[model samples]
Target: MSRRHVPAVLALVAGALVAVPAQAAHAATVQVPCSVPDLVKAINTANGTPRADTIRLARGCTYKLRAPDPVNPGNGLPVITSEITIDGRGATIERDGQGGEVPRFRIIYVDKTGVLKLIRTTIRGGYATDCPAFPDAVGASCGGGISNNGKMRITHSKFTGNTSASPVFAQGGGIDSPGSAKSTISDTEVSGNHVVYTGQEPESGAAGGGISNDGPLTITDSKLSGNTATVTPDTRSTAFGAGIISFFGTTIKNTVISGNRAFAEKGTARAAVSNGIPADSGRLTVIGGAVRDNVSDAPGGVAQGGGIANNALMTVKGVKISGNRAVAKDGIARGGGVRVGPSGTLDLKESRITGNTVEAPGGTAQGAGIDNPDGGVLRAERNEILRNTATAENGTAQGGGLYHAAGLPASGTSTLKRNTITDNRAADGGGIFRASGGLTLNGDVVRENRPNNCAPTGTVPGCTG
Candidate 1:
């Protein structure tokens, strides 16, 4: 009787072992349902898994994150802490409230140990304000939609209607990366995002209306448009990079930056895309892109760099800079298309700089096309500069096409080679203006500018008025 019982129990145990091994040998793809609770559970499981996981969201479904996570108060979803890839499959994940709005939390947050890959999703209406746990700005909040302190990869996605809502300091309305983050974005759309400050606090401003990265970032074949960085009230700070801003090691290739704005109600406004502010040592390289229809307006303060502004090293090649404007009502407006700071070096080649304007009806405006304000080194080669305008009502407008100001201690240098500067209009120096700097021209065509070509009749050598 005992021998028979032993054999029966052993047979049952052997069956259980074989069944467990069969199931563990082949894992199925984890797919989350359209329900919010299911999605939350799926992400929680993925974060706890040791191996990298890919979770496919319900097709074309909208996952509404109605409330912040209980563990992390500022995040709408679970904090990603492992290698996870969320394949949206045309679905959308948004922070849901009153139109996904008003003091909202972020959609996704990646911790330092996490790696996130987002594909084919749309992240909408995420707002980050007073987020102390964020890696950058500490208490000031950063990254309305997605924030990464680890690594992130985004492809074929969209980030829209997000805001980083601190007036004191903030960064990245659409996406943000702190100093420890590394990201690669490809074929994405980041639009209609904002970083706005309306308080009258002195030096209250923010950076990067669409996306901001303080670490290594590479963006390719993407579109960044309709983003804004606006600072209202009587503040004296500066709002920088309405489209995108990076501190260091950023490269943008084959992207489009258009219809972005930097508006300062009382402070200074920078351009659509900023490599780095003057205080940083960031470097940017832009290739085969278009920067167009951007604006920098500061009626009560200065406006600099309507399109692309650089205070660090920048290399731009095969790009188009067009239809950008810099406006200052009672102050100075400089650089309608591009502005290079004194510590900056710009190497622009084979680009088209056209139809840019510096409009200061009640102030002074300078450099309709490109302005390198005397401490920067600029080299323009084989480019077309055409039909730009520099106009000022209170002061004389100068440099319709390109402006090189007086040299500083660093002594800025300008070299124009095989460039065609034509059809530009200004009060003085319609073609190219060299107030004082090292100017070397070789095979450049400076002609047909309105008012005159080269102000003071002899400022630019090898050019006749």
Candidate 2:
């Protein structure tokens, strides 16, 4: 335990340090040059390395791929299999294939072992062709921009001009995160994305024009607009969420979903945002966002759930759902603002649903503002549902502000408190309509509609014209 032993210990420590690989000591920072091949090589090197790496891309460069990557077939870059963060200095990574026909392959694919953090990048012109069965390869031929099965955090980015097309079904025109992925997207713009599916079932058909999150995901301070989800299913099913669809527990905070369209051969299901599935329960919490100017069109079926659709346990707080439309060319039009499905339960508070509309060219137009017609429940408090309209070109209109078909076929409850339902227009039940269900209204004002308020006056107690 003296100076002689100190020299021996120091020698042993130096030998051990020499045995450790340089990459294992700490994460490396890789700088990619201003060229396509260089970017690909950098990604490949970082992915092949044995540690987390930060790849700093060339500033203001456009690394466009000329062909498919050999490492990851049908992709623009190597498959991500390691923890890597691409610090893009206002750059773009896209595919520039033959004739620029929206390159058939996607831009990025993150494997299950990967953890990708992409920042300050723009991804565009990614076109994903379809597959007959999804949830198979995260539906390999989907998610035009990025197909993520691992952890991903994307911030300060843009995804535009991406597309998903299929003869049967497709999803995630811009991005798809599935299979137990941990994803967070913030300060992003996801617009001009499109999905088209011509299948027989809308439930598995065109969905999530902007982003699809079947995993646990959190999106904040993002804008999703001008996304289209079109489904031509032969039969009846739900094509949900033209702007965004989540089938798992999701949180969307301070995000704006506007100008998205959902069109179906049968029905649009929902235009702006759709949450959850019917067989299994899900949860979605939307706080302080705007869902505006979204459209749900169905020439073959009904126009339902124009602004927001929920089949999960959803909670909407301090949000605005206005200027949305539900158009039906041959069937009925309902739920111009928000629709709660048979298995859904909505807890909407401190929100506004105004200036929404429903139009049926040959059928009835009902529930111009909000509709809870099935077994689902609606507990809306401290909200406003006003200035909505229901118009029928050849039939009748009803339920201008709110419609609660409580016990027609299924039994549910509608408990409304501290809400305003006024200045809506319809042929009947201009403010509120209750075909049947256990309805409890307290601290609400229903007035100044086109017709008298609350049809079948005796059906609702303590309310009369």
Candidate 3:
């Protein structure tokens, strides 16, 4: 999580970009050799200069990417304020393999307002084989990938097999961009990246298996799959965002967020796995994308917004949220597929919330595929929400397909129309549960669903009556 605010420092760097002082403005493309020895020399040369320079790497193999010592203070002071472009030449950069130390340094670390673009290269994290005790609690210390605070663009690149240890308390495991920094990633494949945090269970913790975005980010035409966000019980909050954690004003269009799993029981809860958009913040729009096959474990289980945790004013149109599961029994759990928070109203139209489940075993609690409060209205039109089941074994339960509860700081409401709700089962309100307030269903079908405890004892609609 790159949430540090340093606008003044970045301003100074941006100011220098205007007038490059003649002698330094020339297009000086310095070709650094393909080895560490030659690359260091090029960096030293760029540091000594007082202007913008371009260090173009050859089209071969580079053992590692070297950088100025961050702790030495003024060790690479000259290059810190200068603008440089380090471009790879269709090469593969691998991390160094030594003792406990990770092999390669981060691909790029932006301290100035410089622009860095990585094209046609495969940068891999170092192989330490040793999985750290906790990967999610401290993600900043592990830098096998890249960290950017300045404006950057990554095109036609692939990031795989990257790992982050517990570096700083709650940091982004891969590609952390905090504080007013704008980053755009296009045509990229980020797979097999992992954030491993040791859970109290010794094998759990929520790591942002693929990428963590603490700042405003825009991702288009990308695929994030097979990423694991896990948490062990010993930790406080292990999981926040599994595949991607979009902070304020995050937009993901024409992308696929699938096969991302956030496992608990090793921990307590998981928030915003596939699309971790803020609840009561800015806008998080998902246009033309699919969120599927994301799962959460027991105990802490998974809560709300399985495909996305939107606590803010969310409008999801032309999207599909399917095959998501949330299971827990100890305490209370809601929202198997999606969960809306207080001061949040989710307007979903032309979408599908099917094949989702919420089960509680030997416990007293309620679970729903889409959990909405009376104060928080979930308006669904032209949507198909069916084949969803909520089971509360050995205890009283409510709402299997949809559950509407009111108790937020603000008043909640749910207005559903022209949507099909069927084949769902629960102890109470199997098709739809309207606990209180307003539940307006116009032209919607509630058939073939079971409310095991319907009509109670003396009621005419009791069970089979």
Candidate 1: list runs displaced more than 4 Å.
1-28, 99-103, 130-138, 179-181, 277-282
lDDT, candidate 1, 310-397, per-residue tens: 7778899999999999998878888999998776789999999999999888778889999987578899999999999999986768
How badly does each model clash, as a count of residue pairs? Answer: 0, 3, 37
Model 2, range 66-135, lDDT digits (tens) per residue? 7767755556788887888998989988777657554487788777677889999999877775321133
- Residue 15 displacement in candidate 3 (angstroms): 18
Per-model TM-score, in order, reads 0.91, 0.90, 0.75
CA shift of 46, model 2, Å: 1.0
Best by TM-score: 1
Error of model 3, residue 347, in angstroms: 3.0
Consecutive 10-residue window with the lowest summed lDDT within model 1: 11-20
Model 2 stretches with alpha carbons more than 4 Å out:
1-25, 97-103, 130-140, 199-204, 233-238, 267-269, 278-282, 407-409
In model 1, residue pairs whose N, Cα or C atoms come closer than 3 Å (at least 3 residues apart or on different chains), thus clashing, are none
